[model samples]
Target: MADASNFIWYELMTGDPAGAARFYGAVVGWTIADTGEQTAGGVDYRMIGRSDGGNAGGVLALNAEMIAGGARPIWIGYLHVADVDAAVEAIKADGGAVQMPAMDIPVGRIAMVTDPQGAPFYVMDPIPPEGGGESDVFSVTEAQRVRWNELATSDPEAAIAFYKKHFGWGQEGEMDMSPLGAYRFLQRGEVMIGAVMPLMEGYPVPVWNFYIGVDDIDRARDAVTANGGTITSEPMEIPGGEYAMNAIDPQGAPVGFVGPRK
Candidate 1:
């Protein structure tokens, strides 16, 4: 069922929104649109966007209140769920914490969740897109496995269970990743979604990194650093020698880009 609907919108919320807009414009090829803030619970929100001319996502101002409440800066993925209320309850029952209670958005309903650990992911039952990726019972999902989400969780077993109960996601298998660490690719039937790793061991808070597929790895690596992104792990040759690298976007969200090794 995984399709464009499962992950239609993504947002990068950073302290410096202007610098972020410019950096991403160069990296992901997305245009930005700044619409003045609209108040929510007395909070002013500045709107940022790709405006359909670039990629399909936006940039939002980080919530100081949440940060003060022990929230860290990160790029959050809001997956589309069929029923928000039922899904939230199921999550709590399965040991996942509902960091932010379910709230209504103009687009649909959204709720933030932590997988036993504190890494937060957003879930929204979209209003349905006119076309593109949408999850179904038998449809092959993630039209572009080009970009996927990665969750650095404490327990791979429990993580798999939690998602299986909530969204029917399953672990396809573990492929050797060598020096970087073990890689257990995840999927929802045929739809390629994300990866599970041990990056945030024992922190009580998990780290979820997004991966962007580029036609050329070297060019993407250059694009990242050129746009002010930090390369935590430079592109290295995998054992059999394929090319891949890790970097943090201007907002400090870790993402990876991969392609054939030269």
Candidate 2:
């Protein structure tokens, strides 16, 4: 089992759940199924399944009330913690804010929170199903799984420190982006999970970007355009020799995909 501070789940909160589902299904090769279960506020939740029979993430249908409350389409990752309530308090004490109070669901207790720099994510104390092992929603080399988790923040140093303190993440190394800033890699024990970089110019606010893995970068890029999504950044080779690209889904949510050029 992955201890506290690991990303156990990923979720897409979108206004058009069906459309977003189709887009991701085609691009990332996921099989999203409606669970037919209504959440506390009557929200429709769908489960994302990878081709290998493992779970990928989930899709949340945002209601008009949630949108009226300033909710927008977004992809958010969930970090597992031992105690949700304690984590919320630690975050608040560190100048972070809670978007949703701690609440218990079928899975476990969860609370929506933002880092001090205002990037939002969730903290969950999950209750594993009978005999179920750890979650493999995040992977380094598997298609349809989240390959990387990047944080674009106004204060990289502070954000890095905050996550390190709460999640026990360590800054192993970094890549220099020159004028933009350094891209500091974050690791949990031996796993190089993600990185933290300066929030680039023109982006209105700080945010977390998760890159899902694909088999072919070009094919995925084409799928984005053919399915009504806009390519924000063309595929570019990264450190590990794989290519990565950014896109905005039809409903205005920013997303990323990484894979080989072929």
Candidate 3:
């Protein structure tokens, strides 16, 4: 059992699988390929490969029925847990809601859940491969990999408490954002994985924003526009002197990128 209850995998749920594959492939420099596997309902699934030849995540093609049932284009991260069912029960007890009940898949047991603030993510108990190894889907400085996992919620205090209780997370420190609120950094063990901040007025609801690392910020910005994506936020210098920006893909999924300006 993977005892580390941190983000291990990510998946993008999009209506147009092929188009999304192309869009992200160009923007993030990821190699997207068909897994040749389909869900029982025939929805296609593709693997997102990083430049390092490791698995970054996956792209799940949402079918018509899924879309009609309220599924939208979004990127959801999966947190590895010791037991999926137990995590689900504990989450529910703490005011979280289960979007999809725990179920067994070829790789492991997984369940979709939403925090009290309505931010959705997944919990998984993975069946390790022949040689047990950890996932490197997230990295703070690697290009073509997830660099950060940020949560924008209506209630940051409650959100912090919930994650800390469930995942053994901690608030290391915070940066004052003035009128917006404090940006509290989330620490899993000793690594600063991400942060949580109060959701601003413009956002309709709470959501998790994953920022993918790139080699060049300017090149990425150009690719996003050229590939039919909209830049919601222009690239700005972050505390670490790196640049980060938010954007919406052609398929309407929110995404972010971080890197140097070169």
Candidate 4:
């Protein structure tokens, strides 16, 4: 089992699972594998596995009903918890809203929820691995793994407080973005996982964005454009000599890719 409050799984709800599989497979070098899993509604779910053979994330094809109900393609991270039901109650008490109630599945219990600031994510208590504990799916320097998680919310202080109380997250460091104010890095234990900041003007809504690791930043950016995705910005150098870019996948879902320039 993954440590409680850690980000255990990531998932993408897409309108075109096959096309997404193809696009991501090219850009991120993941091997999209059908998990042979189906939801209660009979929709198929697939896994995004890394080249080194670890599980990365998942993809679920959106049905017409889901699309009709305003389900746009987006990626959501799943935070690990010990008890889904108890966590749901605690979140509601803390002013968060339940988008989907906790439910039992073959893998474990899960619920969709939004923070007090209305940034949405999932909380899950996944089934134990057959032999024992699960391996880490996140790495600071590994290609094809999740490298960072970011939140753009209406209230950065309140959002940080909420996460700190519920998920045991702490502020690792801070960066001043001047016009953008402060960008706060969030850490769970010793791992610096993500950051939180105020939502910028003109953004549609407060939400979390995750960055996937890549080996070559320029080639990954090229792969994204050639695979029908849009690179919203030029690759920029980060503090540690790595490059990162913001992009929208072919389905219009925003994602980031980070690595060194080749």
Model 3 misplaced regions, further than 4 Å: 1-4, 34-36
Worst window of 10 by summed lDDT in candidate 4: 32-41
1-262: candidate 2 lDDT, tens digit per residue: 2342789999999988778878998899998774436887687998888888888988988888999999999999999999899999999999999999999998999999999999999999999978988889999998899999999999999999999889988898999999997999999888999999998863578999999999999999999999999998999999889999999999999999999987
Per-residue error at 25 for model 4, in Å?
0.8
Candidate 4: tens digits of C-alpha lDDT, residues 1-262: 2342788888888888878988999999998764437778698798888887789988988889988988888889999898999999999999999998998988899999999988889999899989978657777788899899999998999999899888888887899988989999998888788899878853579899889999899999989999999988779998899998989999978898999987
* C-alpha lDDT (0 to 100) for residue 125 of candidate 4: 88
Q: Rank the candidates by lDDT, best first.
A: 2, 3, 4, 1
Q: Where does candidate 4 stray beyond 4 Å? A: 1-4, 34-36
Model 3 clash count equals 0
Worst 10 residues of 2 by lDDT: 32-41
Steric clash count of candidate 4: 1
lDDT of 3 by residue, 70-163 (tens): 9999999999888899999999998999999999888899999999989999999899977888888999889888999999999999999999
**lDDT of candidates 1 onward, in order:** 0.64, 0.91, 0.90, 0.87
